[model samples]
Target chain A: MIFRSLLAALALMFVMSTATADQRWQRVEAVTQALDNRVPELEGLSLELPLVAEDGSSVSLSVSFTGSLEDGEHIEKIRLFAPGNPRPEVADITLGPLASPANIATRIRLSETQQVVALAITNQDRAFLTTRDVRVTVSGCLVGGGDASAMAMANPRLALAGSARPGQPVTVRSLINHPMETGLRPDGQADDSIEQQLVESLTATLNDEPVLTARFFTGTSANPYLQFQLTPEEEGELKLAWQDQKGEQMEASQAIKF
Target chain B: MGNLFSDHLSAVLWAGALLGVVYGMIAQWSRFCLLRGLFNRWQQNDSRRLRAFALAMAVALVSSQWLAWQAGINLTRTPYHPGNLPVVALIVGGLLFGYGMALANACGARSLVLLGTGNLRSLLVLLVLGIAAYMTMSGVLAEFRLWMEDLYRPTLPATDLTLVTAPLGLDTETGRLVLAGLLSLALTAWALSSRAFRTSPRDWLGGLLIGLLVAAGWWITGVLGADDFDPVRLASLTFVAPVGDSLQYLMLSTGTSLRFGVTVVAGIVAGSFLVALLTREFVWQSFTSPGHNGRAIVGGFLMGVGGIMSIGCTLGQGLSGFSTLAISSFLALAGIVAGSRLALRFSVGSSASH
Candidate 1:
């Protein structure tokens, strides 16, 4: 009886392993192919994510791109993808010349153990890619029955230092409102899956130059908040714009004086 | 100052008043006592009161799980489960806390209600517990606690009780809810069947009302306290931190937001006072001697230190922990009973010698 039970357990383990392996390999292939097709010139984008996340609902992510965004040679966009998720493509952000050269921080959710890919696209349409393996023990996004219509567009709020000198790194805090539906949650009242609706892009421009840009997905908080540092050359207006998957847009501008 | 009475403020005040009225009516009628569980067992050799407390735990466990099921609330994500077990600390902390509760004749929540009736002994105990809790929370004893936490860690890998049930091939959530419900039902049955317990409406009502209070705490923080800019931690009444938090609020009410625990603590005192006044139970009572006062103070200090280390006191761990049915609570509860019994034994031995 013991031997039979052991054999049955081993067989079950083998089946489970094979099933997971097949799904993961397929996802890996699809992700690689998508990266190859979409952002081919990927390089220099470094993703800093926690090695192990206890809760996947608010996993912190930081992306920093090295090298200057000089005239005609700048970062055009950054896209984040969670290959394991049903909607594998999480977010894509477009950057303008006035946006910061690099550095963005946001939270994302992971369904399970999966690779998070960050792809940076340069002005020349070259895509540079980097991937990190994140193990999400239990998905945190499984709250309140994943209903698509339950998501409400949140108003973004910004807070800046009251006073700061030129060339000093001023902290700019921004929070946006949105439910960031992951599309994998079973609908509360329906048998269908909740359609993904997450803020795809955020751009911060200081004096018509890109100061920072970020890509986000459903794993982000209900209302996502971001904090970043910008050494202002002079007191100027910081223009912020964010767009979600449904093409909803919100913009805010703040004037800073030293 | 303009923002003080704004819509948010009105909502908070109304919420507090509603909570206060409910708590006053229920707590006054029920006579909820966390210390009674251990004391009854030690002094009377009766498990009925303890069983009632356990029944409350069972009810809390089932109801909390039900709420979680309905709201999709995940207890595993909370700070209570840091994914690591500090076993030695929990056991030691539980024992110390139990002993203190016996010494003071009340736990933290009871102290608040007792204070409302002008029990000067409880007032000293509250002060000592609060000060000592703060000391341990961020002051001198914090380093020692952290060092001990690091030294005596258990290898269960994860501290969450739900994780243990997850591997049984049963639906993890369903398994947890069933386990919680069954435990609660068993305790409830045991408590209700006893002729003595059934006859005592005060005790049974107290258990039920306290269970509801624990549930109310979860709703306040999880739902009402939910904010995009600043989200409150999902918590219920746990006495150790809240006592310290209440003291801090008194000094820094301007800087901090109104938390549910603090509001609830305030409400309980006000409710109890009103009840006492109405019932003619509002008497200014103090210890006969400074020696008794000193004992109360020392008891409160031990409870503070122990509660902080254990992550809860009698009410905090007893009711709140029982509500969650988190494995750590079981261990802590056992330790508490053992500690109280030890204290009672020593006292009896000393009296016999005299």
Candidate 2:
């Protein structure tokens, strides 16, 4: 009896696994829309997301690309898409030479249980892809912590981590406060006071050299957080700046040493 | 950006497992269960077990509150404090869970302990309960649960011990101390007042260990697993959702990461089985008749759906949630007690027969 039940469970799992692989990515419009109806190969890209999210409002996600490319070709940018959210345009990250080992991390809002896809576009216009499914239950995507006031966006935070030689880049993380107001407020508590605004763009510089640029959309969680690799060839201050929808900008920096 | 615990989740999971093993052993030794305590207190006119439960609550409260005081952990980040307190879900869910507890003849935590001792009936109860919990939590019945919760969303924005003193012009720090101190003292004094409980070192020792285990739960997930980028969920002992998590983990190991709750559940069973073997309490047991099985099935369904509706079970809301001093915990606790009392008075079959 136990063996029969185990066999039945295994059979059911086989069907589910096949279904997950066959249908999910083929149907997501965001990936095909960016690649112009061509599905990107999942050869050299990886995405990390919790199978079950702690809180769906601000779920932490990381995507990285390490695929070899033809000579004179570099991976220029990577875009994130949460097909489940109201505003699916998650983020667009443009990488520079200083951003070694193209990797990016941030928090995004998921409206429901769905697959999130990452599309990495190279300088040659070739795209590589990876995706992960996150389950968001009833207790998901609720009102996040912190106030929605304009002043709430004041105290931007930046930090550095990871060990590398002076010529090599270390991990750079930055957080700036903003509601990422998607124009659709589920809670409606701060609907009146909070305007529909987000930190549209962010740029980082090390020793006055451009390192990273990212475009944030409404799908980004409140208090937009981001992490990427930045090279510290010479010892100087690392600066991070944020620009909101109204063209308002915020800046924060930290010292870098070998 | 999220590497500290994310990189070493196995270590955190191991800690949870160790704690679960400790809890299971202690529970087996004490036969620590709220249902058993209630049954004995009301049906047999003995309150020794009930007092032990109270003592456990007291220790958990004092220790968990101390952690919060020291900023060793942030209690406010927990799910017990949603924006709109779902008062309706609490009463309905708690009542169903209580009734289910009486019908199934064991609560979620108790059932796990029983399963460790080779009770086949507990296996059935756990499977149904886990499925039902997932049904209400994220499955087919989720829509209905969400609708009911949204229909009646009128309640205090945030209800905790400080709610009492906030209106009385006392600061939050003073209010937490004043309220938690009085309640903890009253509970401890009541437990100690019972000569039966005081005389039984084994009973009080169970209470102490379980309480410390709950606090250690918070420490493992909240403090030791604390990471700004990849923070672990602030949770302690609660069996309703964790059981479902364990079931999901069994099937979807490749897709998902191992969570603390699932590991805790696994640890509890192992720990209980170890103690049961050492004590020679490992005896195979099954339902006597079909009626007994049917009744337990109903009980399991109610517990699964109800536990999710209320967002916790006896251990989840009654002890772990209570330690946070959240007011919603009190309402759920009251509902559960009332439901169990109703079931005890009106249940058709004998509770002890199963």
Which stretches of model 1 miss by more than 4 angstroms?
A: A1-224, A227-258, B1-21, B45-48, B155-158, B348-354
A52-88 per-residue lDDT for model 2 (tens digits): 7745777889998777888867678889998777667
Local accuracy of candidate 2 as per-residue lDDT tens digits, B1-354: 235444546667888999889988999899998887888888788888888889899989888989888865768657776556777888889999999988889999999998999988988889999989988876788766767676675545345768878888889778888887899899999999988889998789998889888888898888777765556788999999999888877877765668899999998899899999999999999999998898689888889998988878999998898899887688778888888888888883355632
Alpha-carbon runs more than 4 Å astray in model 2: A1-60, A69-73, A107-115, A123-157, A174-201, A221-225, A242-252, B1-8, B155-157, B348-350
lDDT (10s digit) by residue, model 1, range A1-258? 999999999999999997775344235664566456664433577898876654466677777787555576877667777776655655556666444455566677676667888777777766677778776533554343333333666677777745656766566778887777655541212224346677777888877777767677554666677766666778888888888887878988888788
Model 1: per-residue Cα lDDT at residue A15: 94
Global Cα RMSD, each model: 17.8, 6.5
lDDT of 1 by residue, B165-268 (tens): 66776666667776786777788888887888877877887787777777776665666655545555677767788787778778756534455667777887
- i-RMS for every candidate (Å) is 13.5, 4.8
Summed backbone clashes in each candidate are 17, 0
